[model samples]
Target: MCGIVGAIAERNVTGILVEGLKRLEYRGYDSSGIAVLDSGAIHRVRRVGRVAAMEEAALAENTNGQLGIGHTRWATHGGVTEPNAHPHVSGELIAVVHNGIIENHDHKRDELKGQGYAFTSQTDTEVIAHLVHRHYVQDQDLFAAVQRAVKELEGAYAIAVIARDNPDLLVVARMGCPLLIGVGEGENFVASDVSAVLSSTRRVMYLEEGDVARITRESVQVFDGTGAAVERKLHLSDVSLASLELGPYSHFMQKEIHEQPRALSDTIEQILAQGFGASLFDGDASILQGVKSVQIIACGTSFYAGSVARYWVESLTGLPCAVEIASEYRYREAVASPDNLIVTISQSGETLDTMEALKYAKSLGQNRTLSICNVRESALPRFSAAVFYTKAGAEIGVASTKAFTTQLVALFALTVTLAKLNGRLTPEAEAGYLDALRHLPGSVQHALNLEPQIKAWSDRFAAKDHALFLGRGVHYPIAMEGALKLKEITYIHAEAYPAGELKHGPLALVDENMPVVVIAPNDALLEKVKSNMQEVRARGGEIFVFADLDSHFHDSEGVHVIRTPRHVGILSPIVHAVPVQLLAYHTALSRGTDVDKPRNLAKSVTVE
Candidate 1:
């Protein structure tokens, strides 16, 4: 995903656009560029590296304009070069910065070339500038030109356009990608993320699919797909700039790991503040009463969170639950039932595969949809029938930490609420569950305290080439998340298997060099998991156990133990996920890898 920001202000906005791009650099850092409409002409500058370089180039060129747009790209359509950077210009009339892909770009490029429009870069985004130029030549209106050009394209996109004639206006549009307008006094801003414009404005309007906005210094007018004027509410962003800064930590990942206590508390407190009698689902409770089963569709870390929810939903609600990888779920001819509840989880809320999967489910007449997500105004929440906002704040790290744990908190709340509505949970059990949930913040803080010990264990993993993570029952998904974090950040080969699945195939890869990291929560199958650890130890596999302090699993020659503070049964996944994240962060730090950006990774997977 690329980060885009646009600002139309009375004063020169070169520094404003540069600062916004810096805030959004976490979304993409491969290349950066800026375009401005100044003195009846469009000025553009591009760089192949960080936003700092792009800012330097802009300053050297003395780029300045009241209306402008900027982009930090992760490079999908072309190589990471100055030519492939965003703010592509068509002639000297139009400039465009885009995020997401244009699926029909090749066909459009061929047609545009037939019309004698020359292309400069290998990006699908270049077609937009030329297409807009074509429309502008016909109608001579920039706003109408953007609408006419978008109708000719396909796939996801959020774009900002600036034209030489319209020096005071910034036209923006979104289709299946995130875009929002930030409201400021006598000035306005647009960006792919709220954090990008937080320094300028706190009030924002999230644009829906096919929504276009014409932003000027004094006014913002939004129009829907049918050419009808639409009204959008402005929400005050609670995120402060301080939350985005690395105050006392070495990295954003480390800051976010410590922020877990507050993030989890905020998510759970949203429920606890409503009191135990309030409905956890923000919508009607009747929707839960008729649910017979559930289908969870997600990708990456969110999928693992859904996998953890599968164990809880099946056990607590007495319902069949299935988890599907979103990309695969959209392609297959899976049966959809009216009695099934479809749940989608995503941190960014604009994940392409998960969004497409939910749309596919809706196409099959499945309307009972719910979203567990961090952004309240994101596509997933807007499309779902019920919304559970995680309130985890901004997670800028490429490898997720707080978002995963907060998703589990929301999913756990959903599971318990459904259980109560289904007549499966007793009054006493409901009270106990709520009590435990109220203490989730304290429990997460206790887990954060174990970071020192986990960091010590990370030293053993820093030098390893391969590792294995093991768990049983509900914690099996936790093990998968653990292995995923390690592999994602450290570049280490890692695998996760259910303790029972070790003998089936994976035992052969174990040896003295391979570290076996086991999630030994003291659940009912602790004995079986302990025996599974013995199997690994018997094979000269060094065992690194992250077990409950009460599990009585002690350290010996080949076995290393890192005890976590005991937590409530259902919330164990949230607590256990903390140590796993720490281990990965510390291991990555030990290996001197970039924990925030990671290699070849972006924060949001807006493109498929």
Candidate 2:
């Protein structure tokens, strides 16, 4: 989840790199640094705090270089310190910034030390600079040296290497992580994501695994590992400052929570339209013809979205869907087959665990992998046999909102496609569902209006120390996601209990000091959730409910109701998510957190 940026320009590029890092500041980090090649010398500086501190240090040093690389690091390999910060250089032959881990670094470190390669820092990234330096001294070509060095690496990494020997060039490579090369009129750029190089260029070449590139001021050279020149298609990416902005909101979480309406609307547009244009949205029926099982792999909020999607896929398409937490899937050694349809979900598409799981599943015999990601030209999409792009735009907040809603909408589209393919859904059923899905935007908009209602009830939970989140069926995972959001940002003690599980043991924790925030959407399981709410109310616990008007849910002095738009049972999770998002947002705002850049949490987890 570190951010990396590199630039090769006719004039100084350090300022541009710094500005680009600022655009990526939403990606959490503890330290920031940059290394620029100036006058055949490597100039490096870093600070031990936020990106702003590093910017101040950059100005103080007056470092000027036309070719440079920068990194914002959330420490994993070593402690957060100036020495451990990125742009690690050894002997000035090579300077490197890295994201991800080197699992066998200690063995490699011992070997390199035996070879008389000294290091100044204790980072696995420092080993990269030394490894590159050793190869650069032998090959003299930075690109070849990087390729040879990367071939020896054992773990995940997206590395940017700069050399003083070649003042006008930089080398970039990616394996098990994301790296994009930006092509400009007279300059070229590389970054972990589009935000890092959006200031310099909009045209980018997303590097595939084992692909290496040498970037210069006037051109970019793509190469295969065997020293053959390769052609790369320029993928125009939708990355811009306007999408990254928080707009009228004070926190990005708030902006995202409100944007759920349009986010769902945008996703449902092409999916639910006239005719048989269901699957692939453009009427590509091939997506639904496969006879197989669906394996959903994801982490964090995206994982909750997957859990909710599994219910819909099984309900509508009559297909068995299994959802797994990406981090644990490989360890469990799950089985795969030719008819195995694996689907990976991620907002950034660069999530380390999910990416690894997707690759592992795709490589196992005959399996077709599909990715539902918001990022276009992302690593996961490139790796998948098929891709479904979610138009969630840029979700800057660490706590996801719009991305979750859009992913659900995308899954709904897939379910419809599958039903259409199997002849399971008649025209009447399809038309009604599609029409309801089309009006989902208006429903989400109605739900968004309840922000003020939620805030008014926010004071009721302000004095409470712990909260109980309860839901049934599909809403159960929404409860989990809500609890996660509350705890992640507010540092509050929260727990999610499936409504039916409340009386099993969690009932003992209920008291006036506990706020039971029930996801009581009016569905078949409404009575179960309502019973759970009553169970808490009997113990004098405050009841905060998110429900539809038809539940006829009464609002008492101790019971506060947050209304939701009436939608399908499966899609309710996506709509019900907005209020919980607001609850977490207001709770965190009350506690004063850097919502956009949460501490110790990166937007994308690029390592296990």
RMSD of each: 1.5, 2.0
Top lDDT: which candidate number? 1
- Per-residue C-alpha lDDT of model 2 across residues 133-155, encoded as one tens digit per residue: 89889868888889989988999
Evaluate model 2: give its lDDT.
0.82
Q: How big is the positional error of residue 111 in model 1, measured in Å on the Cα after superposition? A: 1.1
In candidate 1, list every pair of residues with a backbone clash: none
The stretch of ten residues in a row with the least summed lDDT in candidate 1 is 275-284
lDDT of 1 by residue, 287-321 (tens): 67778999999999999999999999999999999
Question: TM-scores across all candidates?
Answer: 0.97, 0.96
Roughly what TM-score does model 1 have, to 2 decimal places? Answer: 0.97
